[model samples]
Target: MQLQKLLSLIRQAVDRYNMIAEGDKIAVGVSGGKDSLTLLYALKKLSQFYPKHFTVCAICVDLGYDNTDFTGIDEFCRNLDVPLTLISTQIGKIVMEERKESNPCSLCAKLRKGALVDEAVRLGCTRIAYAHHKDDFVETMLMSMIFQGKFYAFPPVTLFEDKNLRVIRPLMLVEESQVKGFVKRQEFPVLKSPCPIDGTTKRAYAKELVAQLQREHPGTKERLFHAITEGKIEDWALPGV
Candidate 1:
C-alpha cells in the first residue's frame, strides 16, 4: 500500500476511537517485525501533521534472543527523529528453558507485554500504540471463540488503570496484507522470530483458518471484520455510544 493510503486508514482508526489526545506521549512498541515497524513509521509520519500533536517514542522488548538484530531498527527510528528504547529481558530462557511449556506463546506474550509496559510507563509515555492490524483483530477473535469459548477481541482503546496509561491500535483498520506490502516497499528491517513454536501457535492456526474461510466464502474476512467494527460483540461499540 502507498504511504498515503496507509496514513488515511490510520487516521481513520485514530479518529474513530478518539485514540490520540492532546499532548499524549505514545510509545510505539517496536518488535523489529513488519507490523510494528509499519506502525512506527505510520505514527511518526502522522505526528508530523496530525492535529492532536502527540509525540512518538519507539520501544522494543528484546527477549534476549541471539538471532535478532535491532541495529537497523535503531537507524530507522533515528532517521525519523524518534527516540528508541530497548528493554532486554530473559523471557526466552524463562519460557523455553525453565517453564518448558510446549505452548509458550501465551506466557511469552504476557511477559513481553509486561516488560514493554514497564519501560513505557517509566519513560513517561501516557499511552502505547500496539501494532495489531485488522487481520490480527479477526484472528484474535477467532482464537478467543475457539479456545476460551467466548467472543472477545482487543478494544481499540484500553486503559491500564494501574499505570495510568492508555493502549491504542491506530493500525486497526489496516490489514496484515497491507502491512506486508508496506514493509516491502519501505524495505523495513524485518526480523524473523527465533522462537521454536513461532508459527505453530493458535494465532497461526487462526490465520490459516481466516484465509481458508475467505477462499471458500469469498467475503468471509470482510464480514468477520464488519462484525467487529459494527460492534456485534458486547463492549466493542465505538466511543460515545
Candidate 2:
C-alpha cells in the first residue's frame, strides 16, 4: 500500500514539475527521521521499475549533538545495501553555545541544508531530493502568510546557482500523517533533533494551527492540496488591480 501511494506521488511530482530525467544521478538527504527515511525507501523501491534510468544515494549530516548515536542508521543503510555518506559538523554545539536567539530551527535548517547540498555536489549528484511532504508545504505557506506577510511556499523543484544542483521534493503529494503511519508500519529508525530549541518555534505553532484546521474540516487538507496543484488562485486578481 505504501509502495502504491509512493508510486502515485512520484508520478504526480514528475509530471507536474518535470523533476527527473533519463540518466539523472540523485542524492537523497536522510536525517534518520521518518520522512527522509521513507523517501529513501520509496526511491529505492521505485528505482527497480522506473522507466527512466536513474540512481539514488543516501547522505546524512551529523550535527554533533551529545548522546546522538548514528549506529542504528548506519546499520539500517548497510542492510538496505545503499551507499551512505556521513558528514559531521558542530552545528548543535555552536547553536547552543553561541547563538543567543531563543529559536534555532531556521539557522539549523539552513546549515544542514547547505551541508547536504554541498555533499550532493561533491558526490557528483545532479539532483538532490528532500522529504518535504504536503503538510510541510502547507505549514510553510501559512507561516509565510502569517509571519512574513508573503504568499510563498517551497517549490517542488528548485535549481540552486551556487551548487548548480536541481533540488526536488517527491513527497509533495503525501501527507504527514500518512508518512508517520508508513514509518511506524515499516519500523524505520528515527533520529531525534539535538537542537536545544526543538519544541518552541514558530513552525510548531503553524503546525498546530494546521492540525486544528484539519480537525475542524474533514476534507480541508485534500481541498487545500487540490488548490495548490490545480492553480486555483491564479484566477484571482491582485489588489490595486
Candidate 3:
C-alpha cells in the first residue's frame, strides 16, 4: 500500500480502539519480520503528527537460533530514530531441544511475549503494540476453531492488568498483502523468521484453509473480517476494551 493509505488504515484502528493517549509510552514488539518492521516504521512516522504525542521503543527477543543476525534491523531502527533493544534468549533451545515439545509454538510464543512485556515494563512503557493485521486476525480465529473448537479472535486492544500494560494493534485494518507491499515499496530491511518450523504450523494450515475458502467463496475473508468487527464472538466486541 502507499504510505498515505498505510498510515490512514493504521490511524483508523488506533482511533477506533482509543489506543494512544497523551503522554503514553508504548514499546513495539518488533520480531524484525515484514509485519513488525512495517509496524515500527508506521508508528515512527505516526509519532510526528499523531495528536496524543506518544513515544515508541522497539524490542525484539531473539529465540536463540543460529545464523540469525539483526544488524539490518538495527540500522533500520536507527534510520527511523526509534531506539531498539535486542534481547537474546534461549527460547528456541529450551522449547525445541530441551523440552522437545511437539507443540512448540504455544510455549515459544508465551515465552517471547512474556519477555517483551518484561522489557516494556523495564523501559517504563505503559503499552505494547503488536503487528497483527486483518489476515492474522482471521487466521487466528480459524486456528482456534480447527484446533481448540472455539470461535475467537484477538481484539484490537487488550489489557494486561498484572503488568499494567495495555496491548494495541494499530495495523488491525491493514491486510497482509498491503503490509508486504508497504515493506517492499519502502525497501524496509525486513528479517525472515529464524524458526525452524516457521511455515509448518497449525497457523499455517489455517492460512491455507482460508485461502482455499476465499477461492471458493470470493468474499470469504471480508465476511470473516466483518463477523469479527461486528462482534459475532463475545470477545471480539469493542465493549469495555
Candidate 4:
C-alpha cells in the first residue's frame, strides 16, 4: 500500500481504460474517507509525472448533516495542493425526513452524485474520479445480481454524453484493504461519514458476504473482478472499443 505501488496500480487502470488524456482536468470526489483521500493523494502524485499531463482537484458533497466538520479535509487538500470544493445540500433532510423512504441509500446517492456531477460540469472538468476500488467493484456486481437480477457492475470509465463529462475510477485496480493501510500509514486526516445509517446498507451486507466467501475460498474477490472486466458485459468494454 505504499505510494509507489498505489501509483503503479492506478496507472495500470488509467492506461488500460484510456482514462486520462492530455489537458484533462479531473474533479475527484473526496468523501473524506480513506479510499477517496488515497485516491486524491495518489492522483496528485501521479499528475506530477504522468505522461498525459492531467490536473486534479477535490470535491466533496456535504449532505447537510449537523456537527460535520470539514476542516481536516480542507487542510488535507491544502497540503496536497489540490483545490477543494465543498457543496452543501439538503440531501440528508430530503432523504431521511421528507421522503422517509425505507431504503435511503439509493435516493441519497442520486442526489449526492447529481450535485457532484453538476458542480464538476460547472467547474469545466472533463472527468470525475470516484474512489471505487477492487472490493467495491466486486460487491457492486454481487449486489446487482442479487437485488436487480443482472450481471452488471460499473465500468472503469463511464461517459455521460449529455453532460459532456466522464466518470473514472483510477483505483479500480487497488484493494480496499490497501487503501485503509495507505491512509492509516500516511496518517491522513480521515473523516467519518455523516450519514445516520453509515454501515447498515445493502452494500454493507454484500461486503460482508464477499468477505465470508473470501475467507472460505481465497481469491474470490479476484475472480469476481475478473468476471466484471472480462465477462463481456454491456458497456464494460474499453473506451472507444
TM-score of candidate 3 on Cα atoms, chains taken together? 0.97
Q: lDDT tens string, model 2, 110-187?
A: 888889988899899988889999998888878888988876676777777677688888899888888888888888
lDDT of 4 by residue, 93-197 (tens): 999999998989999989989999999999999999999999999999999999999999989888899998889999999999998888889999899988889
Error of 1 at 33 (Å): 0.5
Better of 1 and 3 by lDDT: 3
Ranking by lDDT: 4, 3, 1, 2
Q: How accurate is candidate 3 locally (lDDT)?
A: 0.90
Candidate 2 residues lying further than 4 Å off, grouped into runs, are: 230-241
lDDT of 1 by residue, 15-74 (tens): 888999899999998888899999999899999999888899998988987867888989
Among these predicted structures, which one has the highest TM-score? 4
Angstrom error at residue 48, model 2? 1.1
- Which residue pairs of candidate 3 clash? none
By TM-score, highest first, what's the ranking? Answer: 4, 3, 1, 2
TM-score of each: 0.96, 0.91, 0.97, 0.98
Pick by lDDT: which candidate is best?
4
Off by over 4 Å in 4: 238-241
Model 1 stretches astray by more than 4 angstroms: 232-234, 237-241
